[model samples]
Target: MRKGRGRRAVLAVLFTAGAVLLLGPGAGAGAGGPGSVRQDGERPSFRLRTHEPHTITPDEGDSIPPLTPAFGNTGPVAAPLGVALRVTVTDARFDTIALDTIPRNCYLAKYHRTLICEFSDAVPAGAAYELAEPLPKVSGDYYAVNGSYTYSVWPLGDPPAHTEDYTAQYERGKDTAVGLKPVAMSTLKGDGESTGDGEDTGDGEGTGDGEAKGGGEAKGGGELRFVSDGYADRADWGIEGIKLRGRIGEYAEASIPEPTGAAQRVRVEVPEGTSFAPLTRQEREGLPSEIDYCTRDAEDGNIYCSNPRWYVTLRVRIDRRVEGAEGRISVAEPGNGDTNPGNNTAPIKLEVEDGPTSIDRWVPPVSGFPVEHDVPLETAGSDDLASPPEPSVISVDGRTGVILLVAGASAVTLALEAFRRIRRARNRGGRRVTP
Candidate 1:
């Protein structure tokens, strides 16, 4: 009877142990718990966080702080328009670094450790700077171990608009440094109207209806001519000689002498209703000094000289038929030579009697220098697109096996306790089990 009781007690304990195992923590899915399901469906993600070493938040009304003078081993440095910095760490031993500084509004963290440092405004436009060595690093007790870094900065704003009428030439050295070369005598001509347009009536020689009949010559008999000394001294560079002629209601023509050999004569017909203004030698230097002029009636406009080396002479041939129409030509100097070349060279004022039957004028080109450097060439092939690697699970703790062991031990302990209780109950009821 004792042996049967002991066997019954043992069987009761064994049955209780099995029931506990099937009903406890992980029993809902057999070998799979909620944690397992979550783990199987999740993926890994990463983020970056950065912080400045100093605590300096400017007040709303405070001006930006003056930049610290470049410190550390100094090489070459450019002034920065602004700076963005990122700091990151990867080891648990250095996690304290994250708490040492405030993360900028634009940063994040990954795995509670890794820190990414991005520094913009490292260099500035027009100003040069130097760096003696890589940014200083904190080690051992502070943050980051064996840190490595790289950086790049660009000119602060879009390349200044290239509107200076002068073509830019770039010269780049082996180190990718660039320099500018300027050409001053290049000219760009735009489209003009045809000779049939009723616009170019000569000064005061028009029939009052914007028309000049054939043989309707100027009452004041004079020829218009341009004169210039063929020298391009820095002070008086823009100079050229030419003549313009056309009938009213028709396109005018510009006849300029070529730069080479006694200035070869070339004629180009411009559209009618076109006005003309000849730039002075000073105003034609390049951008930052380019001059623009316009006129209501091209035939009577006066071309003023910006430099001492150039001048336009409009000779009027007064005829009996239009003698009552007084057409006087005047030249206005940009007074005192102290006026800002930019403002002093505003368009000249001209008044015509009936408008010229035709209008035309000769002007020098604003650009005439070879580019100093070749423009950057395009890449030969399509850029390679790199697909991001698929994310994989990464255990936060280095010893993942230890965590698994701990979980298994806890489950076993729970089963063992249940079995012991059952055996005690069985024994009290005259039933016992043996292992």
Candidate 2:
């Protein structure tokens, strides 16, 4: 009888110890349980709010503000150490706006058209996490509605940094969805036929036939002008594993609208320390199959494309990280009725951050990307520096200070602009930014 009692006591003691370790000290002491404490690994409870543009005009292919989502911890017990924000495109008929098309921190989901962007950061209680940059570029016909954007933010095991396993955090987080609304044509002016206010030109001169033609089938015989397609004001470079490298290596192309006459080659000149890398078969699969042949010039280190079909891509490579590397891409021969020769040649200037170190790596080119469908970044002006602006903390709801994380060059620019605008509103008078 005594042995039986001793065995029962031993078992009871072991169970008590196990429970204490799992629940932590003072378990279920106050109104809330020990799970509410950080030491006991409090689970983050949060809320999410989504913000999208009120309306968009298909004719205006220019980037609108991004699909901004905000999040904050709603639970009083525990402050989340870190979290991740994921924005997914729910509906988009055209593949251009798909997530894979987005540049950084984004990839294609299991469902082909679905795009998913995951950004990780430290999110404290009472503070909201948000993203603003690389404004999303969308295009659709008048009265045509694309799909909506769905967003969710959750705590991560290792956040402020990305981790492979974060599924459980999602279950404990929050989510919401917003629709992509295009402006009604009735509000626009003039007939759609005229290239006026009412026209939803997929490009500058499109007829809303679901095509963005520069000088091709849309408007025939205006002028056979050949210009560099998709030229940006500035190209910024980023650091790679402590090395100074092209964050998004420069890419340039000249889109041939239609056959005006016999074909001529396009010339792309590289700086002394840089060279042009041609697209491989896999990379060229999705691109237009119009390139007859491309070869690099031995003497001048220039690239020439002969009989390029719809368009030709020239991916720039930095053979040596030299300072002030500048190059140009242009049509070899001017065509008839080429009125705008100024835009014919686009210059490529590689801008690096303020300080560049000796860490440089040689990355081999497996494939090249087309400009039309690739992710693009832009800023208010070309004169701005490539590096992210200094950090600034803004108080939201007069509670906690929300610190903006610099994700990329474009994000840095847009976030700075957002702050400037907020300050401007306050300075104009006593303007209160509604939380």
Candidate 3:
């Protein structure tokens, strides 16, 4: 096999995340019921499946179909929590990562050689998260190179599988970690009418018991909004500052309650090519709590969650080979004093794909988010993924980024257009031509 040279494989990772509200109905919710803060509630089992085998040609303009591997909350009613996911590239010339739908929070970093993905929050119980992004990458060449990555997930804080700091994965032994859609629901519907918790148009007033009994509708709701710059074709360039917005509000009839650490634990998720950046001193001051960084030890970088009144915003920047983002985020914490736990957690559906973007938006944000989302990259039938390809290097001139390869030549030549032009003219004129 020809040893194709390209860019260095900077051990990269794709991330997914979800929130686990510690105050499960099974546990006590009042101040002293179950030690809501320390419960750790039981961690749920995670099931990860690969997509079917697919072939493609990678080129500059061709947007290749992104490999979508999905992880499901196959466990029972456990507090929402984050999981650790890993993708092992075993086999092509190069590959890129992107997310159409995103998690509550996700961060991407270069591992030794492979991508180590971790989520900020937890995967919801019995919730199915499929990556909403189509994940299309155009071909840079005509070679039908096969690319693949093996994905695995484990509970974020699981014993022998977790670290105090997420970045600890770099120095310490490999530790695993931990969406989307854009689902905007104003309120629940019963028999096609807004029968939330309150409201009566003179015809008949809505009662909590009636609405809850007649239709299994939720009392309160929220929205998930994500903005991403389209994926990049080149390896040198990257996408930056993808915006993640999560707003927790009530459906008109829903009652408001006092804020608690639960409000501080609201989460935001991101995808593989994206990761959270360090928070600024000012941003940190306005944040609610450090739930995001609560688990991290000294050396491990961490960012805390905020206790916002109704909204939280997170910024994720592009690493490399990132096209779009797709994922979901919602409040999974125990509600302040709600009789019905039905509205405790709500899932939104969202997905974003490749599109034209402004030059200014090309760079994503420098901030990072915790893992937690509804985005799941999926493949139907049996999960059959192509083995990940090997890494390569690409050399470009500052001006032209042009490289010339001579057949059977040992030396690889890299030169700019100016150098080539001067050389060409010199060869033709042989000192006869004057500048």
Give the best candidate by lDDT.
Answer: 2
Each model's lDDT? 0.25, 0.37, 0.32
What TM-score, over all chains together, does every model reach? 0.15, 0.25, 0.25
Q: What C-alpha lDDT, on a 0 to 100 scale, does residue 309 get in candidate 1?
A: 18
lDDT of 3 at 180: 33
Better of 1 and 2 by TM-score: 2
Model 3 lDDT tens row, 1-435:
121111111111100000111222324223311112323444453333323333332332333344454545535644344544443332221233332222223333343223334454556665545445422222322222223444444444441211223353332222222243322222121233333343211111123322221111112211111111121111121111223322111000111122322232333344454455444678567766622221111333443233224333444443323334443333333212333334433332222333323343343334332221211223212332222233334423422322122211212122233346556765886657557
Q: In angstroms, how far off is 251's CA in candidate 1? A: 1.2
Instruction: In angstroms, give how far residue 183 of model 3 lies from its true place.
Output: 12
- Assess the local accuracy of residue 349 in candidate 3 as a C-alpha lDDT between 0 and 100: 21
The lDDT of model 1 is: 0.25
lDDT for predicted candidate 3 compared with the true structure: 0.32
Cα lDDT tens digits, model 1, 1-435, are 786567657666655555454455335442321112222221211101111222113231211111111211011333233222222232121222434332232222323322222233433222323222222222321111112221111122211112111112211112211111211111101122111212113221212221112111111111111112221112211123333343222222232222222211112212122333334556446524232222122332333222111121222111112222222122222112322223211121122234322223212122221111111112112231222233345445535655555555565566577667767866899855886
Kindly list the per-residue Cα lDDT of model 2 for residues 1-435, writing each as its tens digit. 685466556555544554454455546554321122223344454443423223434453422324444444544433333543444443232244324345454443343333334444444545544445432443321122333454444444322212223232222112222222223222222222223111212222323221111111122111111112122112221111111235333333333232222324446565544446666677667655555335575535667654534354345554334577666655522322343444456555654332222223324333332221112233223432233343344436322311212223334455456556656755876756898
